[model samples]
Target: MKSDERMRLMDLLHVLKKRYATKAYDATRRIPEETVNQLLEALRYSPSSVNAQPWHFIVADDEAGRQRVAKATPDIGSLAYNRPKVLQASHVVVLCARNELPESYLTEVLDKEQQDGRYVDSTARDGFAAARAGYVKQHLDAGDVMFWNQKQVYIAQGFLLLAAGLLGVDATPIEGFLPEALSEEFGLEEKGLTPLVMVSLGYHADSDANARLPKSRLARDVVFSKA
Candidate 1:
């Protein structure tokens, strides 16, 4: 890249880093629709395991709906009423992970192969063949592989949070809501999705105590190392 362009990029990076502060907006603050679209657009580009892209987002907007979620996820800590506020905010974005049934993976790959014009060399084809063989070896005797699938689903969750942070929208990552209760409350099966985390977005409120707390972090002594 040219020097001028590199310097411009660096300036933008500096501004973004400096601007990365958390502010909790109260439910009363109204969020604009365009801002919501920009946040979701950022998530659309986030990377996923094997491009599985197994995540869905549900935006909850009604009073009864938020109350149901608030009661269900109490263990999510401190902010027990967060779900209701989330529903009251200009918008509430819910992140969900779709369960991946093992049989469907093979079905998807075969479908992609049938449509694409790209060629896979014998070595690459053999590598995938070997991988499938090994996956079978590890799980054939076991009754389930739900744990493996959930781990990948979390990558999508992380992406959603980071995207919200980058869009200059204040968000609270909510997991305290009742899962099964929320699913039934939202009529999710009707939409072919499941709830994961509830994120509330809008302008920050002056009385939010969380916005006043210092950014907490563990010392490098415990968190990192050099070989």
Candidate 2:
């Protein structure tokens, strides 16, 4: 590879190695509007099963909104530890999963795909639609449609974290909350949405101990093997 390409690859690897789940955020430090928009765009292109795109994000960029999202996490146990992260972060994004995948939704997505030149021919479009339907049906039959939808949302969350890393922002993926409370707090049921997970984004506070800890992972030999 060329020197520039090798340097680019090394830069990305360094970002991955340096990242950590920030435990505290400097409430005063905010990500720029342009950078935040870029992160949102990264989420918009996150990969999903057949590009189903069964997710929505509730971004709290202000104190009032963050307070509302923080309602689900009470002051108790390990969950309380994350409450401050939400309230103090520059922004908090609540990733939600669609409660159900209706045929109409899939049809709408496929129509847009055709408009965007996603298919070379009508047959290709039809086959893509059929495959998406088949996978949705299989999940429904197994009684795990919501679970599967939530998984897609998780995949998108990974994209957000990666983008945050490359942008030199601190991030923390949070799950220590009452799911039912979160759904009710956001009135997601009425909107056909269910809360899956939340991620806090900002610069790490001086008190953020996790930011100072060394990166830890299993040995490459133990985690990866030739197939």
Candidate 3:
């Protein structure tokens, strides 16, 4: 690259680095709805087990809904850590995963694939389709899907956090809330959703002190390798 191009790139990188200063926000700044939708849309494309896309989210923007979430959080972290600032933020996206998928849909989709002319033998196709359905049913009954779904949820969470930062919105990833509390309050069981993470989104306060704190990291020797 040319010298001028390299210098320009470095300047842009510095701007990005300075943007994410760990700032704590107050209640005054509100996150826009368009920003929230774009961030969540990024998560919708996240990879999932079998493309099941098991994750779900509950957008908490109303005062009553935020209060319910605040009440459910366990008071164990640093006082500043679990601040209701999240509740006051423009929105709190409660991430979760669906506990179950309808077996009928699974069977029907598989059966349709068998009829899509991918196989040469009609009789053999019936046998193969039946076996696949049985296999899927056995795993679904064994209850190991949650283990796989949890990985997808984390992927979505990572995407959401980065998208928020890229959009110039301040977001905090919170996991201190009681999942069961949220599940019950929202009646998530009926929707087949289980709570996983809470992400609060909004603009940061101009005078918040967290931005001034030094960023910390483990030594490079402990984290990276060139070989």
Candidate 4:
């Protein structure tokens, strides 16, 4: 491998090694708006099955919005552990997946593709949309469209984590919150969205106990298999 390419690979591995699920955040310190916007952009470009981007993000940067999300984290349950993280993080992102695909949304995606010069002719545009529609239909027929969409949302979450790491920001992907309560809290149902997961972003407090813990993972041989 080329020296520069090898160094780039090492850099990515280093970033992955350094990142962890931050347990505590420095509430007084906030990630700059510009940096946060870049992180959101990273999520925007995340890949989805058949180019059907069926996800939305709610950025709770304001105190009111954060507090609203915090309400979904009950004080006496499995989700209770994430309450303080929600309240104290500089910002929280509510990742939502579409429950159903409306025709308008399909049209909008195709229209954007045309606008972006993805198709050279009307036939090309229609052909591409038809191919994507077939993929959508298979999921719809199986009554698992929402499940497929949720999988795509997680791809965006992975992108968010990597982007946050590259920006030197601390982040924690949260799945413990109440989905029903969060949906109501954010009025997601009205928008045809279901809250699937959330991620809190901020700088970690110096005394964060999780920060001091060593990282652990399964053995490489156990996780990988040769075809």
Better of 3 and 4 by TM-score: 4
Model 3: how far is 142 from its true place, Å? Answer: 6.6
Ranking by TM-score: 4, 2, 3, 1
Residue pairs clashing in model 2 are: none
Q: Which regions of candidate 2 are displaced past 4 Å?
A: 76-78
- Comparing 2 with 3 on TM-score, the higher-scoring candidate is 2
How many clashes show up in model 4? Answer: 0
Question: Which pairs of residues have clashing backbones in candidate 1?
Answer: 72-178, 73-176, 73-177, 73-178
Cα lDDT computed for each candidate against the true fold: 0.60, 0.92, 0.72, 0.92
lDDT of 3 by residue, 1-227 (tens): 99999997886565455555334666876677787779879887777655556678887787776777776665555444565655667777888986765766555555665567656777776676667556556757887767666778988988887777678877788876677878888888888888888888787776767666555668989999898
Residues 155-191 of candidate 4: C-alpha lDDT, one tens digit per residue: 9999999999989999999988888898787788898
| Candidate 1, superposed: residue stretches over 4 Å from native | 1-24, 61-80, 105-144, 187-194
User: How many backbone overlaps does candidate 2 show?
Assistant: 0
Comparing 1 and 2 on TM-score, the stronger one: 2
**Consecutive 10-residue window with the lowest summed lDDT within model 1:** 14-23
What TM-score number comes out for model 3?
0.72
**Which residue pairs of candidate 4 clash?**
none
